[model samples]
Target: MASLTIRQLDKSYPLAKGARNLVLNKIDLTLHSNEFVSIVGASGCGKSTLLSIAAGLEEFDSGEVLVDDQPIQGPGIDRGVVFQSYTLLPWLTARQNIEFALKSAGYAHTERAEIAQQHLELVKLAHAADKWPAELSGGMQQRVAIARALSYRPKILLMDEPFGALDAMTRRQMQQLLLEIWETHRLTVMFVTHDIEEAIYLSDRVVVMKPAEIDQCIDIPIERPRDFSVTHHPDFLNIQSQIFERISQPLEHA
Candidate 1:
């Protein structure tokens, strides 16, 4: 069954002279249960905007977005979002940050601590659970953000370049950790990124978008439990090259 469905979505922003700036146009996408889908495109392609809309953090001008067949009205516990920024509360420890989300989602106060600790360990951050965002590394902070998002057990995880600010090594580590989390939880994920390799490596399908609409939906076809070694494989390189070509093509011709 489809976990998230977006149909003919249209969004626009008002311009200076009362003109409308079209952002997303006639966008349609459907993500099945436990599927990992990534959206990649050039800057100004409305990638983040689409993700925000899915998170119910932004409104659309037309069309419909649904979670399990129910139209999205606004932000809810059903959708969890993580952005490029770590977004952790500076005053809270890693564990407290996740516990905050759990509390807001109506989890029992007594159980929140244990649940938060479990999620921290899920992201391999149990060792740093007591550390504040300032004391932790960038990667660690993002892991905490992810743990907080998942702590509520949202139906879908919406990530907008969640690792964009991390170092290369940390980015790779987070990607591996995310893959493991998705596999373990059987999550339905919608990821947005500018990194082609990251998208291909983590996604079952890549949705290539133009300025306001989807250009193509490319299947990775790579076997799972993937590791760093898969990056050097011939199939991986070929798929990367193809996505690059699509991304580099002119918008009018795309």
Candidate 2:
């Protein structure tokens, strides 16, 4: 478990006239140890940008980002990331994919094999350990990607719409599997997605982000061990509506 804190974060890209396109603005957020938080927003709202910065994949223009109160230097072993696209090395088998990540974390050949097998089992992909990425279905490939990400035992996990490319059924299944793993591991997770129900189903709190800043954050009052049935609960729909209202807020006229 770890603490992630971002204070007054800002990020912008250069525009045609040397002006900047502000993508993130004074984004302040914190995830307590073992908390599952999801960031949701309309397209082009900088949700992925914020997540990327936290993963140390991109730099912010200003403000401070810290993990466990320590300033992030760069992409470190302390954080693991999974994205919509399965970023697995194609030539490697499922098990080998995980082993490859462990190797970079400085595990010996023997330990890499052992740890790889263990994580594959954690994601219930042990049966397909030897299958190449091409042989695995979309869901199966994602499982392998998840296994590889977690094999190193990173303190926090950042997922950027990891289930976005999956079909509806597979997306549901993956969400269930992810929640199971999160519960078992007691992890600090920051997930970015455009799906409201998915966020409500998987997150302890859903943070609604505006185009260039956070709009609001709503706590999910539902009980844990969530399932599809939770979607039918009135409270779930109510929270979902609240988030929708925030996301749909119109920008002020210039």
Candidate 3:
């Protein structure tokens, strides 16, 4: 079943003096259950805007977005979002951050602690459960963010470059961790990123977007249980080259 469906999605922002700036134009996309889909494009291409719309955090100018066939009107527990920034409360520890989400989700008090610790352990940060956001490393902070998002057990996970702020090494580690988590939980994920390799590495299919619409949708033929070593395979290099060439094209508005 399709977990999320977006059709004819057009989004614009009001400009000064009664003008409008179009950001997403007539876009159509669908994410199947347990699928990992990544949207990639240059800056100002509206990839993040698309993600925000999917998360119901932003409204679109026209069109319909559905989760499990029901139209999305606003933020709902059916979806969980993780942005590039580690949006944890500074006063809350790692576990507390997740517990807070659970509490807000109406989970029972006793169950909240158990679910929070389980998710922390899922992200391999159970040992750092008591650490504040400032006390954790960049990658660790993102892990906490992921754990918090998953604590609600949303049907779909929306990530907008959740690893963009980490160092190269840490980013790779997070990628592996994410893959493991996704496999374990069978999540339906829609991730947005500017990094082509990261998109290719983590996605089952890569959706390349231009300024306001999709340019291409390419499937990664690589087998699952993937690791960093797959990057050197011939098929991986070929697919990467094709996506790189597509993204290198000059934008119409540019």
lDDT, model 3, position 203: 92
- Residue pair clashes in candidate 3: none
lDDT tens digits by residue: candidate 3, 1-254: 23899999999999999999999999999999999999988888999999999999998889999998899989877898999999999999999999999999899998999999999999999999999999999999999999999998999999999999999999999999999999889989999998888999999999998888899999999999999999999999998998888788888543
Question: Per-residue lDDT of 213-238 in model 1, one digit per residue for the tens?
Answer: 89899999899899989999999999
Clashing pairs in 2: none
Q: Write the per-residue lDDT of candidate 2 for residues 1-254, one digit (tens) a residue.
A: 89999999999999997899999999999999999999999999999999999999999899999999999998999999999999989999999999999999998897998899899999898899999999999999999999888989999999999999999999999999999999999889999999999999999999988888888888999999888999999999999998887777776610
Residue 46, candidate 3: how far off, in angstroms?
0.5
Model 1 weakest lDDT span, ten residues long: 1-10
The models' CA-based lDDT, in order, is: 0.93, 0.93, 0.92
Error of 2 at 252 (Å): 3.6
Weakest lDDT window of 10 consecutive positions for candidate 2: 245-254
TM-score of each: 0.97, 0.98, 0.97
- The TM-score of candidate 2 is 0.98
